[model samples]
Target: MRQYLPVKKFEWPWSRRDNGQNEFSPLIPKSGAAKVEDEELGHVDNEYQTGTPSNQDHNSPTRIQPHYSYSLMDYFLKYFLFLCNLVFTVLGLVVLGLGIWGLSSKESFAQEKIGTIGTDPMLILLTLGFLLTLLCLTGCVGALRENCCLLKMFSVIVLVLITIQVLFAIVAYTVQDQIEGYLRSGMLAAMVGYQDDLDLRFITDEIQLGLQCCGADTYRDWEVNLYYNCSAPGVLACGVPATCCVDPLENGTVWNSQCGVGAQLMDEFTAQSVIFLGGCLGGISRWIKQHEGLIGTVGVVVVGVQILAVFITTRLLENIHRHKAHA
Candidate 1:
C-alpha cells in the first residue's frame, strides 16, 4: 500500500520532459556539453539578427551608416560652374544670333551663294556658337544634377578644346612665315571681293581705318581689284578705298569718299600725304607685339579655368564612387 502512493514531479519552466528531474537533478547534474550548446545557439540567433558572423563580431565593430559630407568648396564649385556655363550659354546664343544676322544681312544664304556657305566667316561663328552652347549646357546641367556621364562628356570636350587651342597656338608660333603668306592671300581675296561683298568690304574698311594702313602691302595693292585697276573703265579705276586715307573726313565735317580717288596712281611720297603707305601686315604685327603681355595673360587664365574644371569634375566623380561603395 505504501509503495502504491504516487509522488508529484517538480517541473522546471524550460524543461519539456514529463519526468522533470533531468532539468535540475541533484544526483545527476546537467552536462557541461548541454550548457555550452545552449550558449552557442543563442549566439547564432544574435548573429542572424545582426547579419554578421558570431566569431567576426569580436574582430570588427558594427558598420556605421554612410553620410554625404558636402563641403563649402563643393557648394561653391557647383554653383560657380553653373553660373559660368549659364553666362557662356547666353553669350553663345548671342554669337549665334549675330552670325545669322550677318549672313542674312549679306544674303549669303541665297541659292547662288549656298555652295560657298562652308567657307563663310559667318559659318565659322555659327559653328563655334553652336558648339559652345552645347558644351556649356552640358556642364550646366551636369553640375546641377551631379550626373557622371554628362560631367564626363563635358570634361572630355573641354580637354579636347584646350588641346586644340594649345596646338593652334603652337602652330601659329612655329609657322609664322606660312601664316603671314596665308594672311596676305586672304586679305587680297577679301579686297578683290570688297565691292561685291558687303561683309568683306566692311571688314576691309574697318581694318584699313583701325590699323591706319591700306590693302595688304601697299596702296597700289588696290589695283588687284577689277574696278580699281588702272585699265578699268569705271571712275574708281586707279583709286583706293576712302578708308585708306589718313583723314577720310573733308574739313573735319563731312566724309570724303573721293579722298583716295586716283591715289594708287600717285607716287609713294605723294601718296603718303593722301593715304597711308604702310602695309596692314606690319601694323598687325606691331599691335600683336604691343599686346603680347595681355594676350598671354588671357591665354593662361583660360587654360587655368579649364584645368580647374577638370579637377572639380574628378573630385565629384570620386565622391560619387565613395557614396556608392558605402551604400
Candidate 2:
C-alpha cells in the first residue's frame, strides 16, 4: 500500500538535477566547474552545456588566450632603429674626440688662459657631440635589448629638446628686432679675445672672409682692440685683421699679414680699395634672410625624425608589453 507508483517524469524549463545543482549563465563561459549563482541568494540559475565538456574552470591556470606573433617587420624595425642609433653614436664619438683634440692641441688648459676656456666656441661643439652620443647610445641599447626604461628616457630627452628648440624659435622671432643688438654684444666680446683666443680668431677670420665684410658694424670698429686703437704705439695701430683685406695674399702667393695695416685710418674711398667696406652684421642678416627657407626645412626634418622615432619606440614598447603579458 505504501509503495509509490513510478514518479511522474517532469522537466523544469530552467532547472536540472543531473549534476546535483542548478546551472547558471557562465560569466567566463568555457568550462567544466562553471561559477554559479550564490547558493544563499535563493535564486535559480541556468547554464548551457555543450556536446563536449571542457575540463578547465574559470580559475584554471591553463587558460587559452590569444598570443601576439611578431612579424618580420617588427624585428626589422627594431634592428633598424638600433643600427641608426649606433651609427649616430659613432659619429658623435668622432666629433667629441675632434673637439678634445682641438682644445688639447691649442693648450686650452694652459695656466695663463685656462680660466677663459668657458668662452671658447669649441665648447659648443663638445657639448653637442657629448649630448648626441649619450642620447644615441641610450636609444641604441634600448632598441637592441628591448628595454623600456632606456627607450622612455631617450624619447623623453628628445621630446624635451624639441620642445626647447620650438620655444627658443618662438622667442627669437618675437625678439627679432633686439637680436641684432645681442649679436653686436656677442661679437664685441669675441673680438676682445681676437688676438688671445685661437678659436675666436679662427671663427672671426672665417666669418670676415666668408661674408666679405669687416667688424661687427664697421672696419673702424677695430679701434675697440687696444692693440689696434689709433693711440696705440704698436705698428699694427688702427689696422684690421688680414682677413678683412681685399686680398689676404701678396701676389697670390705670400701671406699678406700686414695688408690691412693702417687701412682703418684711410677714407672710405681709399679703404674700399684695400679692404671690404661693409660690416659683418649686415652681411650676417642678409645671409640669414637668404637661407631662412633652408633653415626652416632643416628644422622640420629634424623634428619629424624625432617624432617618428617616438612613434616607433611606442609601438615597440607596446609589442614588448604584449609579449611579456603572453609569457
Candidate 3:
C-alpha cells in the first residue's frame, strides 16, 4: 500500500528524494503560501539573489574573480611595461650619444658673424623634451602594471614637467629678445676674454705718397721762385707724403706717449673668450650631425611605446569584460 504523492514544483536544495539525491528542481513556491511574503521582501530577495548568484559557487568557472589571481593581467602588463622602458632607455642612449657628439663638434669653434645668429633656445627645449619623453614612458609602465603608487608618482611628475615646459615656452616666445639677451649675457660671461680693441690705421695712396714730388726744382726760374714765395708751404705741394704703410702697434708698447698695464692681455682675453663660446656652439652642432642616425631609432622607440600602451590597455579592458560576462 505504498503510494507515491505528486511531486511539488520549485524545490530548492532541501528538496530530495527518498534515495537522498538532488532532483535539480526549480525553487518556485506553491501558490498557497505565496501571499505570506510581501512584494517588497520578494523584490529585495530577488535583487540580492540576482546580484549574488554570479559569485556564490567556488567550483563554478562563472565567477567574477580578479584576473590578477591567474597572472593574466600581470603577463600583459609586464610585456607592455618592458616595451615602454626599453624604448625610453634606448632613446636616452641616443640622446647621450648626441650629447657626446656635441661635445666634440667643430662648429662649436666657429665664430658667429654679427646679425647672423638668432637665439633658438635649443638647450631648454631639448632638455624639457627629453625629460617629458622619459616621464611618458615611465607613466605608461606604471599604468600597464597597475602599480597605483608608481602611477601616481609618474602622473604627478609628468604634470609638473608639462606645466613648467608650457610656462617656459610662453615666456620665451613672448619676450624673445629678453630671453636672447639673457642667453647672450651668459655666453658673454663664458667668453668675454675674446673681446679686442682693434686699432686699424688704413693708409691710402695720398698718405703713402709722402712729400709729393715738386717740379719747382726743374723749373727754378724767376717766375717759379716768385710762385713758390707766394704759395703756402703745404697746399698742392709736390714731394709730399707718399706710399701707405700699416703701423701695427707693438704688444705692451706705449703709443701716443701713454703707458699702462700691458694691453696684450686684452687681446688674449678676447681670443680665449671667442674660442670658448665658439667651441660650445660647435660642440652642440657636431653632436647633432654625428648622431643623426639615432634620431630615427629614437622616433621608432617612441612610437613603439605608444603602440604597446594602446595594446595593453585594450587587452586589459577586454580581459575584464570577458571575465565579467562569464561570471
lDDT of 1 by residue, 1-327 (tens): 967999788878888555556655546555788777867888889889999776674686677886777778777888888888889999999988889998898788899999888767788888888888999999999988889899999999999988999999999999999999999999999989888877788889989999999989888889999999999998899999999998999889999988888998889988899999988988888999999999999999999999888888778777766767766
Tens digit per residue, CA lDDT, model 2, 222-303: 8888888888899889999999998889889998998999987799999998999898999999999999999999999988
Better of 1 and 3 by lDDT: 1
A best-first ranking of the candidates according to their TM-score comes to 1, 2, 3
What are the Cα lDDT values of the candidates?
0.87, 0.86, 0.41
Error of 2 at 9 (Å): 51
Error of 1 at 226 (Å): 1.5
Worst 10 residues of 1 by lDDT: 17-26
lDDT of 3 by residue, 1-327 (tens): 235767667857777555543333334433434445555567778878788653447556654654434365557575666566667656765665554354234243246522322322223334645764676566566655655555556645645554665577578669956754564454333222111201001111221122221111211111122212224263312111111112223363533211111221234344232111122223333555688679657855655545555555555555545655655
The C-alpha TM-scores of every prediction are 0.81, 0.80, 0.30
Top lDDT hit: 1
Runs of candidate 1 with Cα error greater than 4 angstroms are 1-61
lDDT: worst 10-residue window of model 3:
194-203
Q: How many steric clashes does model 3 contain?
A: 32
| Clashes (candidate 1) | 0
lDDT ranking, high to low: 1, 2, 3
